[model samples]
Target: MTVIVRDLRTEDRDDAERFARSRHRALPHLLWTAEGTLHLLAHTPPAARRRALVAEADGEVIGTAQVDLVHDSPEPGQGCFTVYVAPERARRGAGTALVRACEEHLAAHGATKLFAWVLDAPAHRAFAERHGYRAARHAHFLRLDLTAATLPPLQPAPPGVQLRPAAGFADDPRPLFALDLETAADEPSDVESGSAGYQEWAASTWEHPMLDRELSMVALVDGVPAAFSLAHTDGRGRYATAMTGTARAFRGRGLAKLTKNASLHRARAAGVTEALTGNDGGNGPMLAVNSWLGYEIVATEVRYVRELG
Candidate 1:
């Protein structure tokens, strides 16, 4: 059977659903939905040169890849690509085909360095190495049984600080965007992202289909947005923490912990059965927060890097 690689047809609902299904099967710890997938395609900035590729075998989408340049980073020529093949379709060469197509597209866009995240399984690591990718930083995918696990008791808000849902900023989300920009700048990662402009943030983040503002928690210090936990829920009882962060000045007071815990509680109350989150291995504080919340390390992935010739 010949496996053909082609760009995903976002306008085709079936194609989008198949792409999301492939991702869900390959990485079950994270949430995926057709709407969320389409939102990514529609909102990607033009300068990013993003492309979603699918590998089709017998008219079935068996693998997918998300490739794009790091547009917001100060450095140019940096690219990111992640490939995933449905578990049942592995060993069919779909993964290799998708990766090759992704690399060709990225290189044509002036990408000098490419980074990919590979599941930490032996076979997955070997496949990346064989393709000239070297393992770099590691990250963990944590899971919490929101329906069964006992979460920490909700703590009273600190003096002068109030825990509120992100929806409270519906009229004007600039404050939340500013807080996100500040925390994102300090996040531990290989790529350094410059401050995201309001228009960009509105299109890509605030308008995302999966972002559940009602369930997302925020910490307000005297009416100022200081810390927040961005929540994303796949209409199917699955919820994930898109991001959890605190402004620099509020870092030491456990506001990050406070916001995340409050969000998780809200998620459970809303009938979300499973909660998922990811953290860079070097991010000690976030890792500690997840552990304290009874999250288990369900899976791990390592970022692999390769330089284009």
Candidate 2:
């Protein structure tokens, strides 16, 4: 059987569903949906030069890749591609074909450095090394059984504080945008990503289909948005915390835990059965908060880097 790589058909719903299915099978810890897939394709900034790729074998998609340049980063010539093949279809040449296509696309766009997140399994790590990539930072995917875990009881807000849902900001989401920008700038990563403009953030994050506005909890300190937990639900009983952080000034008050715990509790009440999140291995504070929330590490992935000649 011949495996061929091609660009994903953005206008085709069937194509998007197939792509999302392959990705979900390869990485089960994260949430994926066809609508979310299309949102990324349509909402990504033009400068990103994002390309959605798929590997077809016997008239079916067996692997997928999201390739793009780091447009918001201050540094130039940096790009990334995350490629994954369905677990049941491994070693069928689909993965290698998709990787070659991803590299060609990024390099053509002036990428001097390329990075990828490879699963920490032995075979996955060996595949990255064979492709001339070296492992760098590690991260973990954490899971919580929302339906079975004993969640902490909800508590009243502390003095001068209030817990609100992100949906309350629909009339004007600029405050959430500002908070997200500040926290994202401080997130640990191998590549330094700069902040996105309000318009960009709205399109790529706030307005995305998967963002669960009602379930995402935000903390208000004297009416100012200080901390928030961004939630994404797949409409299939699966929910993930896209990001959870507190403003710099509110760091020591345990607001991060406060917001996330509220979000998870509401998510369970809303019929969400599983909760997922990811954290950089070096981010001890967030990791600790997840631990307090009863999250357990389910899988790990390492960021691999490759430099072009």
lDDT of 2 by residue, 106-141 (tens): 888899999999999999999999999999999999
Tens-place lDDT per residue, model 1, 204-244, is 99999999999999999998999999999999999999999
The stretch of ten residues in a row with the least summed lDDT in candidate 2 is 192-201
Model 2 segments beyond 4 Å from truth?
Answer: none
How much RMSD separates candidate 1 from the native structure?
0.8
Model 2 residue 250 CA deviation (Å) reads: 0.6
lDDT of each: 0.93, 0.94
Error of 1 at 308 (Å): 1.4
Would you list the clashing residue pairs of candidate 2?
none
RMSD of 2: 0.7
